[model samples]
Target chain A: MPAGTLYRGREGMWSWVAHRVTGVLIFFFLFVHVLDTALVRVSPEAYDEVVATYKTPIVALLEYGLVAAILFHALNGLRVIAVDFWSKGPRYQKQMLWTVVGIWVVLMAGSLYPVLGHAARELFGS
Target chain B: MSSDTTSATIGPVEGAQYDADNPAPYIEAPRKRTGKTPRATRGNFEMAAWLFMRLSGVVLVVLVLGHLLIQLFLDGGVSKIGFAFVAGRWASPFWQVWDLLMLWLAMLHGANGLRTVINDYAERANTRLWLKGLLYTATVFTILLGTLVIFTFDPNIR
Candidate 1:
């Protein structure tokens, strides 16, 4: 909304934006996660009760989304490092991003069964 | 090539011969700091933060991915996770240290990242101050709480 704030939109700028978005999402999730785990200090039932909510179909979808966010953040983070440390990183950042995306797609596809398979089974009665 | 105009115009200096082989000395931009500038104004905190992001990020890629693999992917997936699963993992000193390192590094890394975001987006000075205040408070609280949980966890606290 302000001048000098937006850069020329491209792979570089969009990746930066995605990185910020995912980082914020993951940070907020970490806050909740820490609080949830602290429930263990309260009682095993309390912790297990909360964790049960995580096994639901709706929450399974959210978990998948979380995985997507974390995976993107992690992979693109490596790309950011390359752009900083490697001599020719800047020159090949676009290529590296595509590579990151490629790997992300594979991992996400591989993760679907592990992450959401139980939810699918519960919903469909397998 | 306009010979008359070129001949009348003087180069950067009267008798200086600037060519590809020997270029003119570089000029410092306006407001650029010099040797005489105060050191306090040029503190290395931002640089350190920048470096910390990269270093912690590389390590987090390993730590977080491995964590996800163990918790979400292996052996019955999320269905297998519960108080008992966590108890089993945290029982080992190896996992305790792994989790401790992860909690610290990820918390600090995320906090510094959000600090940058706040500085960038919060327009007014007071707005930035208050946002960062809340951010720091939450960050410290979460870090302390998580660390306490990890260290003081009782496997048999039924």
Candidate 2:
């Protein structure tokens, strides 16, 4: 399928697309993460100043999105592997996808306190 | 000599019995075409990659989520995650290994996944090769630099 058709694809296909997109995003995050952490080696003052910036409302919101992406990608990635290697995995692929989705929903729900709570406080001071 | 020189032709896959509904007799199949399916270099590379993605993904879930929970949304949230915080965490070998494993697995998995994407979409062989070369170089540089910083980090350095 063409790149455009990827979004228009079925659930399994969309899962694949999500996996790839999330993987790429996380990769970029890691790239910056290393660079920023390396700043500690230069000077703790430099490191603290940069990391402190992430405490704002906007960055908190972005962090929430990052968590969502990583959660979905990680859960669906396991499903992908199951379908690839397990003997009956193909037969149960849809079920597995749903299961992953269910687990992801639960995990994200649990994380809401941390992700959105702080963001809301930072944004509205509540 | 001319009779002995046959063109490269593919025959139907073995055991494909004739069907009366599709009664057309088979001729020699078309020769290898540029757009034809590539040879199956069926190396363990792909199998290992597939396995590595899943395995690394599982580990990454734990390492990354824990790291985020600690560094971003815990104790005092991102405000608490600074040089001193990092130094404190890295003081423990557990945190150091966690960060190191997270770094290596995520980089390799992301690079490999992108490699598949490039192979799938980059039409020209040269484009594919060049793109992958660029990706590999970046991946290697980031991984090596990140690993060195993680291990050689001096916490007491003012």
Candidate 3:
């Protein structure tokens, strides 16, 4: 709310915001995931029927987004630990955040084929 | 040891509240600690929770990423996943333990994280309480359900 607050406009704040958003997203997904997986106890047919939805092109895209969220959260979480514990972490926090972003970009790019390849194949032609 | 002697260099300081011989009265400090306040009541639970976040986080980075790789990135990705795939994986004791540990750690970690968020943003006292109550309930239910599913899973239940 305050104008030009250090945390409000800076990398530290944005990374923290991203972390919370991604963490919440992942947490909710975990609930649904557990319930969905629990269907295996119901019946193989019932389980497969539900899992079929996950294989759809739309759901595959969502899965890609899920991967993005998870990767960011994991990487940034480590950065947060460094800022808390490392003796010189505060001095280099900005650099570490940029580093996290860099690795995230690379990993996200790499994941496209593996995570979205099936959907791409399905949407287009294998 | 030489309290009885006072030299000019060690003269009584300006507005000195008390000297060693005239000890101050025991006024209850603002954040008083007393024998009545048991250690268990004020233990480092929050500190433990904070430590758990970092520790479990380090482990989860491995467990969860590996899980994502296997489930969503390998062997044709989600297209290859189905009841049979899950059954095949769960058939092994190693995978079972991996999943069990992941389930417990991830659930607790997330629940605690959400608790922090709720405490930070929820304005009303009742709102925070309700949100946390719901969070804890869901966490417990999900963890127990996942655990039961893992242990009681019958691959032959086709």
Candidate 4:
């Protein structure tokens, strides 16, 4: 009934929201991905052409974002399972969420090295 | 040690109003968790779906990462991915099986996740049924098409 209750969300609530958002995003990506890959069945040239369009700067950046989303979704997904199944997971739930976030940050940083390096060369290289 | 202020205003904000249209006090509906379902009220499907997400996600970390590394990072990265590369990779049963497993697991996991979403948000029973029906159809079609593509892929079918 109160506006504070409407706006104020704890970590679990936000985490659940992010999980749903990322999961839906990945599902949409896979839809396009599958359809494009299926182009290979039609002809390799078609497949190569479709894949080549993804080499541009914007798509490259989105790919990296996709990677980050997948990483978070996967890690938090594991936490969801633990919370649902493990005996002590609820007690340490906040710790589990933080642990997943920490891993996600480290992994995203590591991934940026390869993803951004390639993107930079593609965008700037003569 | 006790510092109290009479000027502090701690109270609920005014958001609700009585409406003449409905002849009743209007209040925002409490968030309804539409969690009841055949699966929830009957079988072990939700639990299985829960377990599958974790197991498939763990395996997908390996399968998807390996696939991405080979396709997007190794051998000059995305530019190197093409007809010949895919043809060559799928030539081996190893890559074929790897892709097969990835396709199946990711699709099923994602579809199940969406099924949960539909169950939660579709609200009306008819809408939820239709949405889930559409989801399952697409899932089956993609999985079958993908499995066929993996196993029956002809490198020389030019």
Candidate 5:
């Protein structure tokens, strides 16, 4: 409970946190997604109109945010594998942390490039 | 001059004679002693995994929060998300890659975390093996399927 002290316990603690978080996100998103699809069943015209509204800049931003979540979850998972299987990896714990960060950064950058690029191009003719 | 033959056999026992004025042999012990000590060093893998959980937890806070704000708060909320909504988002390579990244990260993180849980709790060797096997199978399947959905999504699918 003291400041600057890290809590250490069982191995699955982080994974449990991640699993719960990702599960909630995925579940919530899937629910909304499925409901929106069902709108098509109610009335295709309304669904088409509603879907069209998602092209706004705000929605685009949210899409990018989702990308960040998924990337973190996946990369951290790989870190878990290395720790669980590899023998000499214990020494490289710090290195693995940095690698996860690096991967997240690279993936986010790559994912955001096209949308931001297009937005920039439209805003400023080139 | 020593009566002991075994002591003299190995080497010249210079300090074999322990007199009041003279000291005993300051035998130099071998530098590298190869034998299992009672207290073995803790497994390095477990130490690394412990470190990983803390680090990953901190990062997950940001990722999860940002995801929530966007999906559940921004714009008209969850009501706006749809197939065409996804299609429109993915039409641009940015969202495609974004979804792809999210899919991969969450699956790997969740899967690995689960794997640790299985290893720690499963009593029998077979139980641990089997639980992990199922976990890995599900994780791999979900990840691959999600990735495929992200990339191969046809906006025109009816």
Candidate 6:
């Protein structure tokens, strides 16, 4: 009941919160993605145009956000599964949370390499 | 209620022989004191949710795997999965239903799982409210849009 109590408000809880948030975001994105892909049936040109929109700066940034969401959701889900199933996992919950956060940062950075590289090249002559 | 009188009236008895063969009768405790009563004994909501998770999870496994197989492996693999291929697949009622089932199952399963996670984790009352609000919003939006697309997809353009 007191403020700032350890495990009163903990790391695992925040990880679970992020998981649900990301899962919902990814689910919504999936619907849009599936429908957009389905549009290929109507017209090839339309499909191409729709896909071309993804290449825009804003869309690319959104894609990066999606990638981060997916990574966090997946890694945290694994952490949840581990915690639920393993008896001794509670001891390592904070460790696992930090590990997930670290992995997400690394993966996101790696994934952004091409996008960032291209942006740099476009802005500054390479 | 006089606490001193109650204690004085009940003193500890001396040298009671333990009878291994004849045990004392076990009296049922009051319902409120026991705290073991089922919260929703009259309803089937919990049972239905449990069943839904298993059924939806089974269906999701198939739907997701089948989706991946078709999109990633069949025909010329990923390269052939262009606009025309997607349109061709959506042309059939079978594929539409397949997609619809996949959409519904995955959404519901994911939502239910997240609900469980939220209940297990979110401590603050306001935090839970805001998180669930966002979750329900996203889930409803996705499900509605997906259903609309499945039913209203048109293969032809003027």
Q: In order, what lDDT does every prediction score?
A: 0.92, 0.80, 0.91, 0.81, 0.59, 0.68
Off by over 4 Å in 4: A1-8, B1-41
Tens digit of lDDT per residue, candidate 6, span B1-158? 69877766765432234353223445586555346766756688767877786656556546765674575334533334445666689888899999988888888877777777777679998988888888788788878877876787666643
**What RMSD value applies to candidate 1?**
5.8
DockQ of 3: 0.66
lDDT string for model 3 (B64-101, tens) is 99999999998998988988899899989999999999
Q: List the residue pairs that clash in candidate 3.
A: none
- List the candidates ranked by lDDT, beginning with the highest: 1, 3, 4, 2, 6, 5
Specify the highest-TM-score model's number.
1
State the lDDT of candidate 6 residue by residue for A1-126, as single tens digits: 685544334575567667768876877677578668656546778887787666555665676687678667666666665665679677688898899899889977876644444434445666
Better of 2 and 3 by TM-score: 3
In candidate 4, position B75 carries an lDDT of 66
Candidate 5 global TM-score: 0.43
lDDT tens per residue, model 1, A1-126:
778777767788899999999999999999999999999999999999999999999999999999999999999999999998999998899999999999999999999999999999999998
Candidate 1 regions off by >4 Å?
A1-5, B1-33, B38-40
Clash list (residue pairs), candidate 1: none
Question: lDDT per residue, candidate 1, B72-154, as tens digits?
Answer: 88898889989999999999999999998999999999999999999988899999999999999999999999999999999
Query: Which ranking of candidates, highest TM-score first?
Result: 1, 3, 4, 2, 6, 5
The residue-by-residue lDDT of candidate 2 on A21-121, one tens digit each, is 88888888878878888888788888888887777778877887888888888788778878888998887877888898899899878877776676677
* Error of model 2, residue B4, in angstroms: 50
Between prediction 3 and prediction 6, the one with superior TM-score is 3
lDDT string, candidate 4, B1-158, tens digits: 12233223422333245342223455677854366534345577777777788888889878877877877666666667788988888888888889999999999989988998998778899999899999999999999888888877888879
DockQ scores of all models, one per candidate: 0.76, 0.57, 0.66, 0.50, 0.06, 0.13
Location of the lowest summed lDDT over 10 successive residues in candidate 3 chain A: A1-10
User: In terms of DockQ, which candidate is strongest?
Assistant: 1
lDDT of 5 by residue, B48-141 (tens): 6666655554455466556555554455455455655556766899766655665555556556666766775688999998888887776676
For residue B96, give model 1's deviation from the true position in Å: 0.5
Roughly what TM-score does model 6 have, to 2 decimal places? 0.54
